[model samples]
Target: MANAFYKVPQPVNEPILNYRSGSPERKALKEALAAYKKEALDLPMYINGEWVSTDNKVAIHPPHEKKHVLAHFSKGGSDHVNAAIDAALAAQPAWERMPWQDRAAVFLKAADLISGPYRARMNAATMLGQSKNVYQAEIDCVAELADFLRFNVQYMTEIYQQQPNSSPTVWNRMEYRPLEGFVFAITPFNFTAIAGNLPAAPAMMGNVVVWKPAETQIFAAKLVMEIFHEAGLPAGVINLIYTDGPMAGDIVFSHADFAGLHFTGSTKVFQALWSMVGKNISKYRSYPRIVGETGGKDFVVAHPSADAVQVAVGLARGAFEYQGQKCSAASRAYLPESLWPAIKEKLVADLATFKMGTVEDFSNFINAVIDERSFDKISSYLAQAKKDDGVEIVAGGNCDKSEGYFVEPTVLLVKDPHYRTMEEEIFGPVLTIYVYPDAEFDTMLEQVDSTSPYALTGSIFARERSVINYVTDKLSNAAGNFYINDKPTGAVVGQQPFGGARGSGTNDKAGSVLNLYRWISPRTIKENFVTPKDYRYPFLEEA
Candidate 1:
């Protein structure tokens, strides 16, 4: 008889009791989580074309638990940060002067290399280091990284050449200039892809980059450095460093050669960086660019005609994917009173059926949070919800941080739409639901706009034409990225711009043409074909 094909195991719901009581797969995940807590890969910091090993170490925890150290990351001081800045300064001119086609080729090769074997390892690292689920890890760290590089190069090359309205100029030529100096980048752990592109975007445009990746995801960031180098990127063109926040601040502000910063993190961090820029405003040789994408409190609105199955699945994936740590994750939902009970029933049923396990468990729907800080924050939010008069836990309210930074998927129902639970950004697998009276549709939208200090992202689910049109117009400004009948994540690199306005930081939409524009300083090099001494314009006096 022919040998049978052994297919890979798909994620399924078994009667696995708690974290301790599952099959051998679950047992292995537990073991890995336990081992990672105590023993982690030692990551290096890069600067000035050298990978420096540091003696000082910091602990990394799987989001399932805070006490467990998933990895030990090397921490660099101000000296290292300054060295990277200097390296970026030295490399900027050459990188800028390189032909655009060459730069595009380099990034394209890098993307291909990353998507190969490097892609698998990257996905695994994201799962362990950042506590992302299988699909989330695959997309954000591996797939999305490749896409960001490839599309940025292809689309940017096209945009660079597609400048408009040069016709009928008998003796005129136009050219664009790269920024004068180095670009600095500070990225977060939520999406390693964002970290890669924040600096890659500027570097591809001929600017040298100094990147400070979040300590939580240092190992993955280090992998990026390895992949770029393997792809033949010149040393000093893109420098990656691991450091504390203050050290990063000192370097970016003190370096007179620094031209810009591409940041994705908390709003507080952006504010502090902005303050430093202001302090050094007079000392800098040129105006520095500060582009940021901070926090968000995204929403979802459901109308009666909306497909309950579709909305439930989208909301479940949006709320629980990456353990709801994304800036675009849906944390709040508004359901019309007529459809509220049915939606609630489906959501609860979906939530109950979701299998929560380690990323190694391909069937697992939700993985751990990123770190202990995330656990504490989400835990604190739940504690606060217990005391809130109008808030009730509709789904999960339990947390287990003994082995990893893990919190069960949680849903909160608010009796009053104006409750605190509805306003704050509870960045985790926590969703707050509120019912809107059918007659109060307009009023509810106004409430959504007013309640959220952040206007990062929101979704509307309705089959009715009028409902869709009305919500789109009213909530247009509600999110930098708004969705219709879909979850507010998975934005493609070239087609849709990413980033948010209001408290979500500067609207420098990450993968869009607008973002590429930020990386370059447009200098209109108008070349006059006619010799200046031999020819003169009709409006000017003859030389």
Candidate 2:
């Protein structure tokens, strides 16, 4: 049933709220956090619009306060995964056939709900569950999640409006249809917004989804499912499940209805999934669309002309925020020897003022890493750096996990630019600095490009316009989202579409129309207004 053309409401980025002292938002957020901590919730999986529970329960704990049990989620096995896939496939036809405007309305309502009534709860969940400070939680769980939902609806409209040209005698049209089967969305623990976006993006494009969120993130992810339901999302459109990765992959990848994958996780896991898909390609109905955003060894480079204070602030904020869990976090830096002394002074001074503790304390700038596994990995790196004569610990090299998994924001000054910590990904609050001669800036740029297999995010600081231009061009392939004088993190949706290439990801540019294009299969149709009586052309007639 087709009617008049409709337009969705224009999307604007949600304003970030600063939880100032005694502010209403701060008080409300405090109450929400206290309320969540008072009760230990029993969470369940959402399949076919039903909350499915099992006897197998996994306790969820705050990364910074491991003694407190926040929630316990029901974990399922192969049967539940099969049920989720079956539900998605069964729901696919009705969902894809619905009017695009109606589908857009569901997500738009979800955005409004997140922005208004559910904002505090969502933020609180993220703060306690993922061990994020209030500021980080507000930006991620509330503002960024709402932005993704709203902006994605706008992107979907732009996609459907595209059509082909037609002549007077014939009519042509291009129909953007949803992929043949369900999409598998595998989300990570670091970002609640990403968890929502990975599944919601594909589902908004008229495709059904089976979403699997990270175990550490399910505490907040359960709230995401609730918000979607309250927004009037239809049954089975998006089915959230909790199962072991290998068990789920074994069933999903081998199924005939496997159509597409929207993933945000480690690069190695993405590669393994791709390999599995390739081996089972012949079993599927159509070629599955694989889109992923993976790891980053992000960098920050400073020119001799760059201000020392600004460089220090960039390194402090870019490398240590959110315990350096962000994929785009600056893990390595190249500072000119001329500016090293001043930069080091300011950086150390700034690190001295950072308070590390649980998220309940608003003043703490640093918090725990995601879990014990991350803590061990980061601690091992710190231990190695301490013993290595080639590197010197400049500031904050402490690890304590008696109550929570916490590693102090550690800095390593390495003599060699190609040291292991500089090239490899240590996804914690550890920033490695290498001081190079000021005259060898170009050589350093070349080394930067070759140092890491990742091309995620990077920043170059320079006052001179020529130096800026020269470095920008030289490091063209070094990063996907490059900055001139700012930190490489905090890429806003619609402003800087985020992704990377080489070893990082497919660079599909999430939050843009480009990522939406992957979820659709286009078909061009041509209709002839008049038919020829005889099977003959003008050349065959009477030339």
Candidate 3:
């Protein structure tokens, strides 16, 4: 078959709408939330295009209200993993042989579905299940997920059209092939976009996937699966399973057909998985691709010339949004002594005004952490801060888990920059600040860079061009997604391709073509146009 030259539509970042008071989006989201809350959603595992059920079903509840059950998903087992792998192997040949345009159409259509009729439902599911407010839900489920779908399609076409230069008498063609085996996608609980994108990104490039989403995120993950189903994603292209991760891992990692892993989660878990893959390397047909974005102790550093109020806003949003569950959230901050007072005032005011509870209330800026474990973990941090002499609880440090796993957005002012809280990756709404002399900006930058093993996302605020340049250069390896005069969170798809180095991840830079490359293997095809009837070369004959 001859390939035709084709170009994909340029992807644009999906816009996040303000679901403000009396707005249509607010009204619709409220309606959807109410409607979804009333119903008992039985989320099933999708294997080979079939919704499969298990005897062991786990009840999933909203973190904001622990008693309120949002959905029930089957706890899959090793048998389910085996079935999924069988299905993927059965479906791989025809699916990979299918036209590239055909594969691209599925994700593009899924993006449109997310943007149109499914927008409210998707956002509502995220808010209800994940405890994200309207704005957070809109940015995650409605915008970022759609961006992943659309941008991935564009990237697929781009990957396909990259051809090698050939001699005048020869024509060289290059083809991007899917992996020889299925990819295993392990998604985190924080972002709905990540839950969908982790699996779908590889599937868009003609690979099958065995996806295990965080048990907490199955509510919205079900909706994403439905959208992909509606978009006519072929059977076994991306199978979803809700199971004990380790059980699934045991079967998948040892299998000869395990081709790759797409992961977004904790550092410990990722490291463990990597270690497992390494130990079982000799048992596999090929080395599995390990791509992960783990934990981050990201930071925000402000110079003497920086606007304290603006810096305050940046820290508040970056450190506390979604209770700072984001991998890129700013947990450590360095502030000049001159700017701390003003920034502190605004930050304290913002924290005081932040309404903490469930996401149903539109005015509530903060919500509960994921579950009791997260609640207990954060509560322990608060408890430790109260006893620690070097740190002072400046804004808020409170936890009430009677009805929900709620932890207030807490701020810590530490005398020592190397304070435990400042250097660690606490994936919660706890921001640690260290005051430095205004003239010691260079020294402070070096300290922040060396403090954390993670190099995920961070920001620097400075009005002086020279100072900005210096900070940018000095802290280049500290963060992969670096910002100027802005917060470290909220990375837009097309504009800021997100990923980080060191312990943070493989630095694949998701939301761009770079990540898509990891899923594919290239083959070069060369055809000689000149007739060669004789076996000997001209030099051989003459010599």
Better of 1 and 3 by lDDT: 3
lDDT of each: 0.79, 0.94, 0.92
Best by TM-score: 2
Which pairs in model 1 have colliding backbones? 11-363, 37-69, 63-369, 63-405, 64-404, 64-405, 64-406, 65-404, 65-405
Q: Write the residue-wise lDDT of candidate 2 on 1-543 in tens digits.
A: 668888778899999999999999999999999999999999999999999999999999999999999999999899999999999999998999999888988999999999899988999999999999999998898888899989999898888888888988899998999999999999999999999999999999899999999999999999999999999899999999999998999999999999999999999999999999999999999999999999999999999999999999999999999999999999999999999999999999999999999999999998999999999999999998889889999998999999999999999999999889999999999999999999998899999999999999999999999999998989899999999899999988899999999889999998788999999999999999996688877887675
**Stretches of candidate 2 above 4 Å error?**
none
The TM-scores of all predictions, comma-separated, are 0.89, 0.99, 0.98
Q: Model 3 over residues 1-543: C-alpha lDDT tens digits?
A: 647766777888887788778898878888999999997788899999999998897999999988988889988888999999998888899889988888888888999999888998999899988999888988898899999989888888877778999988999999899988999999999999999999999888889999999988999998999999999999998999988899999999999999999999998999999999999999888778899999999999999999999999999999999999999998999999999999999999988889998899888999999989988988899899999999899988989999998999999999999989988777899999999998888899889889999999999999999999988999999999999999999998988999999999999999999999999988889999996898987788654
Q: Which is superior by lDDT, 1 or 2?
A: 2
Q: What TM-score does candidate 1 reach? A: 0.89
